[model samples]
Target: MAEYKPGEMDISVQEKTFDGFISMVTKGAILCILVLIFMALVNA
Candidate 1:
């Protein structure tokens, strides 16, 4: 059986996926904010 070791496993893929997720969420939030501002300006 393999021994368990903390902080010894590769997490490059997980880090990349998380970074992409964060970037997507940030962009989506910015787009929503901009749309809200536009709607408010137009009195919609």
Candidate 2:
């Protein structure tokens, strides 16, 4: 078995996936807020 080395693993893909997740969450939150505002204005 090979010994493990700290900080030697490649994580570019993980970083990209996490960034995309954060971006999607941010956009979804903004859309939800906008929808809520519209609904409130329309008394729904």
Candidate 3:
């Protein structure tokens, strides 16, 4: 087994938060783009 280092857990937590934030932003962007496309199609 690998030795556990101090502060490693904190880094992992931060990484998870960062990943979640990025995922949320990406999803929001995709949703906005999809809505725009749908609106354009309806208006056309």
Question: What overall lDDT goes with each candidate model?
Answer: 0.98, 0.99, 0.93
* TM match of model 2 to true structure: 0.90
In model 2, residue pairs whose N, Cα or C atoms come closer than 3 Å (at least 3 residues apart or on different chains), thus clashing, are none
Q: What root-mean-square deviation over C-alphas does model 2 reach?
A: 1.3
**Candidates sorted by lDDT, best first:** 2, 1, 3
Once fitted onto the true fold, the runs of candidate 2 whose alpha carbons sit more than 4 angstroms away are none
Candidate 1 lDDT, 1-44, residue by residue in tens:
99999999999999999999999999999999999999999995
Scored against the true structure, residue 11 in model 3 reaches a CA lDDT of 75
Q: What is the lDDT of residue 42 in candidate 3?
A: 100
Q: What's the lDDT for candidate 3? A: 0.93
Instruction: List TM-score per model, in order.
Output: 0.89, 0.90, 0.78
Q: What is the full ranking by TM-score, best candidate first? A: 2, 1, 3
lDDT of 2 by residue, 1-44 (tens): 99999999999999999999999999999999999999999995
Off by over 4 Å in 1: none
Q: Look at candidate 3 and give me any clashing residue pairs.
A: none
- In angstroms, the error of model 3 at 34 is 0.1
